[model samples]
Target: MPQPYQTQAATGGGKDQEPTIIIGIDFGTNNHCSDKEKVPSAIYYNEKGEVSWGYSVPEKASPLKFEWFKLCLLDEGDIPQNLRNAAQVEAAQKSLRESNKRVVDVISDYLRELWKHTTRNIRRAIGGQLVDLSRFKVIATIPAIWPAYAQIRMLEAIEKAGILEPRIAGETILEFLSEPEAAALATINDMHTYSPTNMEAGDHFVVCDAGGGTVDVITYTVTKTDPIRVKESVKGEGKLCGATFLDEVFQTTLRRKLDKISPDAWQILEENGALSRIIHNDWENGIKPQFRNTDQHWLLQMPTSGLNRKRTHDQFRFSDIKFDAKDVQNIFKPTVAEIETLVTDQAKTTKEKYKKEPKFLVLVGGFGRQPFLYTRLDDQLNRKKDQTEKTEVLQGSGAEPWTAVCRGAVIRGLELSEDTIESTSRKPNTVVSTHHESITHGFKNDFVKPFKTMKTEFIYSTVTTPPERCDETVKRLCKVRWSSVPDFNSLPTWINPIGKVVRRINYDVKMKSNGVTLDFEVMYKNRVMASKKIGIDYTCCGSAVNQFHDSDEDSGDD
Candidate 1:
């Protein structure tokens, strides 16, 4: 018979701890659910208006709501007026001020509540077949290019929610990773499962994680050995253009229309919570709205007879609004254009710089979930094809896109928590002393001096030496600006070698509004050598790049 539980002496010297069970949390705008549980991120308000949080409770007769508390923590500056009535504003402020709460706090609270519900539900559902929540480790998938402040906020939230604690009933350390990287890992795993073909390392592929809030794309080159040298891949971020932008367009169009109407009615709609509910309901119910920019007219599919459905004394109308496909396309123009620009720019750069063409663009996210969105992208990619035939878009679903990131993150968590993979994260050893703006002296001149450098102190262990070859392929967990560059010459003699031309990498890392973190790799002798970590102050936003140095002692080859 299988032992119910096994105990082994701890490898790191402490008493044996419980085996870690990794749990992935995808904190989305709509709801929070794990791959292993039915619990959702939701809450309800009672008759007296007192709020109670959990999944739908039957005895309370309260309606199911997802992300109720999370929406309360958004930066007031980022929220539109329609989303912020006087009451909501107050509630938001209250939530924001509590423990210096930030976006992650809201996410953590929502997640903690979800976990609570999961435990309860499992116990009730299957007579406690599921393990308790305390034994599980959390792996959260965050934005690709988050600001440092935002990252700290998320960390603080995780800490407060007890994800960082080792208590029996509390969560262990939270493993936060980039959502795009996680998705790429998932794709790689998927490929491994389906295609057993022998692969080589340095094989490159572009990963696109298009979700509700952002479309995160990265180019990853697999690093593996001969006969199977495809373990490692190159990854790069495209841009962030997700479903939230669509909602913004719809909301803006509606807001403009509402602005033309009487403010009193608008206020009533806003105050009564009808506006948010209507938009939310519409989006959830698959009702798309279109707008004519020139005429300022909205084409909605609503009953002409139920025009007064907002009145207190009117008969109930069965219908709401209707949106045409064209209007949907128009509203999504900006977002679509943004993605197109990114793809074109990335494809052009890869061809010119790396001499490689991406065969496919994997589109996994909530926005990518839309079939029409994929069609739009296909049209754009085909229009811009440069004898490369076509840039295919591999799309996923809304119901799964958001969660896929978390799912991928969990796999990473399990790998990390089990000590199978070592974290090669480091702090920045340099600082930027001078800032120079790119200057094009001549009109229509396409020339650009688009790179910057920083001053940092290097830390090196006696046994660890910088890679002999270019560090371009070695990935590290560092916090540098997406477009920021680091001068390899800046490394102290103790860490880097002399007289070899070092390679510099310029990337526009995708980070959440909270904070910035970079995960990059170095390529040396057909293998990864070392990884670095650098912490950036969250407030500053600028271009970041890495430079190489060759000392006089080893010069003359170039």
Candidate 2:
């Protein structure tokens, strides 16, 4: 069932809820984006106040591009050195720590920069009249592999990014859609629009999202055709087998080749900007996607800027560098095997539900678009006994494979609004499932404080204000009251004990009441970051009011 926004106002008898602008943000490990628009998941810094992110961050230049920054967000350690940026995330962490910032903080900063550009682009694409930030809605895509804790922290970053409306007023609703699931939604919609063969009712398929950071797999069983309904048939699976790993392999191969010539030459190549440029140019256009088997060798020309023809053997006649097919196979085999494992596992696990096996496997993501990788997956599955049937293994048809995740997310955002409209248009018994988990977040006030006989003072601060007050009583009529003076809506999420605002917070609160029901949430920084609320009710004490407690006063900075 759609989790009620718990908008305290929704219960107050809304004939119809107002609609908001919908946008989807695909925050990938290697690529971050807003709908169809994308930018790199990178940040660059040279001095204390000098920083840039995404495409703006210069590569193969004097500045620093924080590589594999998103990988550091993972809980596990033992991260491959090649994947950990040339300057290293350790240095980035150290620099950020000096400024009282953490990984999420840096990530949020990058996202904020992206958000500003996105809104501007939206206005240019549409119009300022239709593209209003005040009514913005953002849906973020997360890897299914991210545990609950990681997702919560990602949510914290998403909140800090300033796109989400922090207060609950139906003005802003933020959703977290799984990466593979979002891709699945896009696939289904495309299939519907194009009317692909056997995209029939009851068809089961798996969506494999092979992005630059992680490989995530999700299996879905379609239930409806006219409106195109599907449910996740099995728990999603993922591994750290993304396109970034291939880049790491390429780096390792280059290092080995350079080392064969002379240690000094390899060190210079690694330290200077030359190697990165060669890798970037080759991966984006050359050998990375084109390499199919181990019979061929790839030769790269080193930058000519700082080289002597004789100092570094035949390996460096100003530019010649070589790695054979065996090296390429070694680099890709492990990562490719890992992805193949995930897809196979999802298919096997979903067999009981789908009866035979998944009818199709839809691959989507930047890495998923690789022709060689797709062939490998097809071969792997075909060799398996269960996949003897002619199950289709394909990428998205209507759009580039990389855009599916974001496009699907946007479609989902639209569907959310559409569902609300459809439900409102008809009666309660219409064709809609009440047991759907379509909602992204659900808030409940699990924490309650009991009141005694005397009226107690309660201070309440919403995402929009400093603090407000109302008498504690068993029964009362209430709503979130705003100040006439109008405090800024962009208030910091947390305040110091002395009550000084530190940073700007873009958050929302949803409060509802029959007789004074205060339902809302606020974020507090603890270097860590559910949905819980506060409730107040009278506890029977007869005449001995002094013996009973007025409130369950237990709280901490979270």
Candidate 3:
């Protein structure tokens, strides 16, 4: 028998070292997964302070249970207006306050559990000897529409969860790819059924990742097909119209109907877990995915104690509530409409840029697997009576819909590690550097001249044509600062004409872009003094800084 959870290699080094193993983690709002299997994103804490997470969580709602906590990571202003008043969000927030935990802390705890299970599964598949001896590389997926600050918080949570412990900095042990990009990679690489075998180099396709909490859309134009290379045709767009919101709407509808029939019964159901069972077990697992505009009626059984009591309403004759096809359609209308709008907008943008519709619209994610959603989009895109050109809609194959993002992340990690050539390789979207500058500052002894710290600021504008000079449209992105300079005292000093000792230092400010992120570095004589990465927010032009220093100064000039 093989030993379980035993340490093998101290460090992965040398030519004979084991190959790096790629692990992809899709940290979703409703569920989290590493491979084909997924666990609920819910977490529960007992009175003794012990915690349970994922699949171990109870099916019914509990006061100690925390669900939809992922959305709490967004600032108040960033949350969708409709979701602001959602009961699930309120419950999660209450749980956080009761537990005295921050959103990042909760997420970190949950990720720790996910990592343990993922590694255990890997060990079981490949055996302990190979697993312990090999190095691990993680590729995590994030929402495309998340702001820079949110992404930073996610990274902090991932770091706190100890997922990056095996590898040192600058070794590419961990990387984050946008959800839609990952979905596209999985769909194109693994789904031979929908993969465009005849797709030409200039052909374009759109990927719509409709998950449990967010729906993200992006268009990619193929540059090569032999080894599969593509680039973003337009910036991606996303919204909070996911499957959970549909559940929220359904629950709201049920409550309204119940209140009208019997307020006392509604209260009793809420006090118990009957309402939760109906929503989670009956509607979510059964009705939502199967409803496809068919004329079918669903009779949901209600608790006999309160609902069976005699009432004036004729529909209350039986201890059940009836939901017709129209009722289900109403529950799905608002959320599905939002998703349709997002996909349509992406299609329009792709057409504007490429002068033709995308050849295919590939759908991937847990929500994307819904037959109703696929049928709706198929009819709208391909069967429209007013349009002469139609775009084909394809569901991702070769991997479970919910696992596509994680699988694609693993595929990307493998590609990056194997591709050795400088050119003719699949790479991330090109990020062009727009600005560069060099600044020299002199500090006199009279003005605190130790040169212990230095600061740099990055500013950006979203306007198509930015003003030549800094204006109201320009916003500060982030600030990068470095302290405890090792060579500060070695700098040559001279006496100024005013008889004050002066020290001057010159450094270059360089900006580098990686995917949707921008990195700024202050370099002194080929040595990195300070560096910071800022994620680009495609949704709006707002001030979001990932500052490296605590102090806030207007300028770096002295």
Candidate 4:
């Protein structure tokens, strides 16, 4: 049973009120660091079948530790689904389904371990016995652009992991939020520390959350600062362009070099996991954050244990290989371009729709602090420095960039607990800081027309595959951006928009296996913003049509 905490608000005798701990699990694709607010997302399964998480899990414990498991849900078709490789992934996929392993099942296993271990460190965080689960509030940040079902699946996974009981009727102990949105809340509240210029009400800015797996951008104009709140100024944009893609480019370049040295060496390197170890180690330590030099080339050392015992750089043993400036540039060029495109797209849309440009572009997430990345984006997006043109790109100082999402999540959970306390029968006179009431919420900007409209129910196309049950139907929601005013008389079952379609969030429950899946496409002028699989009886929380709220739909960008 989920019961509100009886804190100082309930009984104001003790100096220390048992804190409502907000534990944010950053379930990253490459790393899972929650015990200390950040850790390698790697999980290892031992021979006895017990699981060990965080990078500290012994290397010898498992020959193949699961990394990039989060990437399995991407289904973008650009990246390979089988991160562990084709053969191993194939067998595991079969075993996974047969064993009833959903994606969240693997995620839950890691989080369950994290939850059990967090108790040891909870005293240092907020100081309270960690016996009861209800004493704490847990929040897991999801990528802003993930499908609605993915969010639901994450909650389901959390409940299954024994962190919280699955809530069917009311508000559960856990809640879902966009990673970028969480970062924005963190940034806006902490503007005094990060922003160059203090932002005022009605001042607009963009939040660019660049992480290992995705880059999510959403523009907002400050609506109020009496406990900060804002309105969505533009449709948020999320791209697959992230830090891991740069690692992929580096991997490709490394493989190309390795193949030239000796194909056998590359094969042996793969078999022994030497190449991967070298690639990630070199990238993370040697090149990634510190690769700021554009003029000079650096050298990358090869693993001494691999089959190609002989180093290729100078035909000497145990020597370093040349990774020239060109090689580094080649590895970064494509990813950098993708990032520029996303930022520029947001900027262009901001200018086009709002008539006034944004004042700041706040970058947060693991990759947000990359100097090279910051330099390029600042050079491109920050076109002005003087008061007239003040838009500049900013990142968190110190560890703020990497930990903003989780920190913001913590702030959110704390606030929720405070609200719960205030609502109690016996409320203590506890004064909270003005910043404590930072509540950020908004309805999705629904698309509507000004002219006369005809209303009709749209039935989706039927499926041809075998039905799992007699009355099974999947609802697919599509986010669309329209290029021009669409003809309501002849609406296309699928959306065909003319403008920038930010993202089309498709649910992972494969439409191929099911016989009857209803595809619900949500359109904004020229873009398909979101799509998802839903049961036949699923209801929508927001609508695309409204007479009273239609005026607010036009973004107040300036």
lDDT value for model 4? 0.53
lDDT of 4 by residue, 262-374 (tens): 76666666676666667767777678877774787767665555454565555433345578878888777787778888887787788788766787888887788788888
Residue lDDT tens for model 2, 69-167: 565564333233443443445654455555565677777777788778777776776666544423555567666544333455676677798867553
Estimate, for each residue in 1-558, the C-alpha lDDT of model 3 and write its tens digit.
001122224355664354556676778877666456556788887889678998788767666788889889877666667677777778888888876889998898888888887788878887876776576756677765555556667877988998877543224356666677677776776543354575667777788888777787888777776666677676677777788888877888888778777767776776655677788677977898788889998987776445445534453333678889999999888888888888887888877877887888888887887878888787766665766667888874334432333332232221111111110011211222321222222222212255445554445433334445555544444545567354546666667677877565656655553433446566677787666643222232234322223343422233
Q: Model 3, residue 78: displacement in angstroms?
A: 4.8
TM-score of each: 0.52, 0.62, 0.70, 0.60
Off by over 4 Å in 4: 1-11, 14-16, 36-49, 52-100, 123-134, 146-148, 165-172, 192-197, 262-264, 267-277, 306-318, 383-388, 401-558
Candidate closest to the true structure, highest lDDT: 3
**Lowest lDDT 10-residue stretch of candidate 2:** 1-10
- Local error of candidate 2 at 501, Å? 47
Model 1 stretches astray by more than 4 angstroms: 1-20, 28-111, 121-129, 146-153, 164-173, 195-202, 225-235, 238-240, 254-278, 287-322, 384-386, 398-558
| 1-558 per-residue lDDT for model 1 (tens digits) | 000111122245333354434556666433344443323345444456344554453322223222334444334433335444534345445544543545564566555555665446545643442344225556666654342234456666666766555655444545565666556656655554455452244445566666554455666555542222221133344343556567768877666555554445445555555665667566534543222223333333222223345544234222334345555667778887777666655555655666766556666654555665566666765675456545566665333322333232222111111111111123222211111111111000010122343212122211123343324322222332222333445422321245443333222222121112233333223343223334343322111113333232211111
Please give the RMSD of candidate 4 to the true structure: 16.0
Clashes of 4: 35
Q: Locate the minimum summed-lDDT window of 10 residues in model 4.
A: 416-425
For model 2, the stretches where C-alpha displacement exceeds 4 angstroms are: 1-22, 34-38, 44-47, 55-99, 123-135, 145-156, 165-173, 267-272, 306-316, 352-354, 384-388, 397-558
lDDT of model 1 at residue 321?
40
